[model samples]
Target: MYTPPAFREDDTAVLHALMRAARLCNFVTATAEGLMATPLPLFLDEGEGEFGTLYGHLARANRQWQAPVLGEAMAIFMGPDAYVTPSWYAAKREHGKVVPTWNYVVVQASGPVEFFDDPARLREVVTRLTDLHERPRVEAWAVSDAPEAFVAAQLRGIVGLRMPVTRLMGKRKMSQNRSAEDRAGVAAGLRQGERASDHVVAELVAEEGAS
Candidate 1:
C-alpha cells in the first residue's frame, strides 16, 4: 500500500477494473486479539456507494467474523505479478548497478464490515457469487441445481459480508521506475517465463514502458 507517485493508480475506473479482475482477495480486520484475515472471493457492486460496495461470505466457523473489529476492515486484491531479475535490466550490462526486484499490481479497499446471517440475504449473496464465477464456464452451475433442503442447509453454515468501500488504494508497479530499455528487457524476460501470470505481467510491463 506504500506506493510511489510513479506507481500510484488513483483513477476510480481503473481501480474498479483491477478489483473486478481479481478473483480472490485477503479480507482483514483488526481485532482485540490480533489481526484476522481470510481469503475470499468478493463481488463488487460498483454502483452501490462512492467507491462501490464489496460482497462476500465467510464460513460460520471462521472466528475472524466473530471477533470484534476495532477499526475498518480491509480487502487486498492482487493482480498480475512477476519476479524481475537484474539480468533483465539494461543497467546491469551498462554498469553492474542493478538489483533484482518484483513487479506487481494491487488494490486495497477498506471500510466498515457488516456480517449478516439472514437466510434470504445469504441466499442472494451466494446466488450472485455463483453466477458471477459460473458465467465464464461452458456448463454453468446454479444454486437451483441443488436440492432446496440441501441448499438451505449449506447456507446455514456460512455468513454473508458487505463492505461499502470507503477508501481505495491502487498500485501498479510494472517496472515503471526502470528506464525504457530496462523495462523492455523485463517485458521480454517475463514473456519467456512459464507461468501464465508472468505473461500477463509482461503485457503490463510493455504497456508501461511504451507510455
Candidate 2:
C-alpha cells in the first residue's frame, strides 16, 4: 500500500473495524510454483499476538494449503471505494489542474500461516465463523442445527487456518490530500451517488476533511 502521511491509518481499533466491515478478504501466499490467492472470510482474534491472529478455512481441494509458504501470507480487506471525478475538485475551476483519482480504505495483515485438518479445531472455527455472520439475523443458523453426521462430513472437505498476525498496514484515501473546499466538493458529489458505499465514503471524506 503506497500511503502518504495524510492517508495512513495506524489506529489498531480503526484497522480492526475496517477489517470487520470487509466480510470477505483476499488471502494471498507465495509458493514455489507461483503466487496463489483465495477469497475467504476470516475472523480476527485481537488478543492472540502483538497485532492479532486471523482464523479462517479453505476448501480442502484448494492447492494453496498444500504448498509451503515462502514467506508470510497476507489477507487484504477492502472497504468502501469510489472513483472521484476531477470535476469535484474546487481547484478544477481555479486552475483546471486536477485529475481524477480514487478514494478508498484497505487493510493488509500478514503473518506465518498454519493449515490444519484436525476435526475438533475445524469444528470450532466453523462454528465461530458461522456465529459471526449470523448473529445479526432474526433466525440465526448454527452448526449444531444440522445433523452431527452431516456437519462432520462437511468439515472433512475443508481445512482450518491460523495466522498470528505479525504486521498490519492500513490506508484510508478519503480525499485527505485535497483542500478543504475541494474535499467538501467531493463529499457533496459522492453523497448524491446511488450506491450505499458511496454514501459511506462521502461521510469519511467529510470527516477527514474536517479534521
Candidate 3:
C-alpha cells in the first residue's frame, strides 16, 4: 500500500479494529503458476500469535490452497470506501487544481500460509467462523445444527487456512492531504449523499480529527 505519511495508520489497536470490522477479505498468494487469490470471510484470533492469526476455509477442490506458495500469503481487508469528486473540494473552486480521488481504510496482513485438513482443526475453524458471522442474527446457527454424519461429510469438501500475521500495513486515506476547508467541504458533501459508505468515510474523517 502506497500510504503517505498523512494517511498512514500505525496504531496496532486501530488497525486490528479495522480488520475486525471487515467481514470479507481477499487472500492472495504467489505460486509457481501465477498469483492466486480467493475472496473469503475470515476471522481473526487477536490472542493467537504475536500479531494475531487469521482463520478461514475454502473448498477442498479449490486449487488455491493446493498450489505451492512461493512466499508468504497476503490478506487484504477493506473498510468503507467512497469516491471523492473534485466538485466536492473547495480547492476545486479556489484554484481549479483539484482532481478526483478515493478515500478509504484498508489493512494488509502478510504471513506464512498453512493449510490443514484434519477434521478436528477444520471443525474448530468452521465453528469459530460460523459463530462470528451468525452472532448478529436473531436465530444464530451452529456447526452442530446439522446431523453428525452430514456435517462430517460437508467438512471433507473444504480445507482450513491459518496465517499467523507477520506484518501488518494499514492505510487510512480520508482527505488528510487536503486543506482544512477542503476537508470540511468533502465531509459536508459526503454527509449529504445517500450512500452509507460515504457516511462512513465522513465518520473516519471526524475520528482522525483531520479538520
Q: What lDDT, from 0 to 1, does candidate 3 have?
A: 0.91
lDDT of 3 by residue, 30-55 (tens): 99999999999999999988789999
User: Which candidate achieves the best lDDT against the true structure?
Assistant: 1
lDDT per residue for candidate 2 within 1-211, as digits (tens), equals 7889988999989999999989999999999989999999999988899888999999999999999999999999999999899999989999999899999999999999999999999999999999999999999999999999999999999999999999999999998888999999999999999989999999999998777
- What TM-score against the true fold does each predicted structure earn? 0.98, 0.98, 0.97
lDDT of residue 206 for candidate 3: 63
The C-alpha lDDT values of all candidates are: 0.95, 0.95, 0.91
Q: Count the backbone clashes (under 3 Å) in each candidate.
A: 0, 0, 0
* True-vs-predicted CA distance for residue 140, candidate 3, Å: 0.9
Candidate 3 structure, TM-score to reference:
0.97
lDDT of 1 by residue, 140-193 (tens): 999999999999999999999999999999999998888999999999999999
Scanning candidate 3 in windows of ten residues, the lowest lDDT window is: 202-211
Residue pairs clashing, model 1: none
* Descending-lDDT candidate ranking: 1, 2, 3
Stretches of candidate 3 off by over 4 Å are none
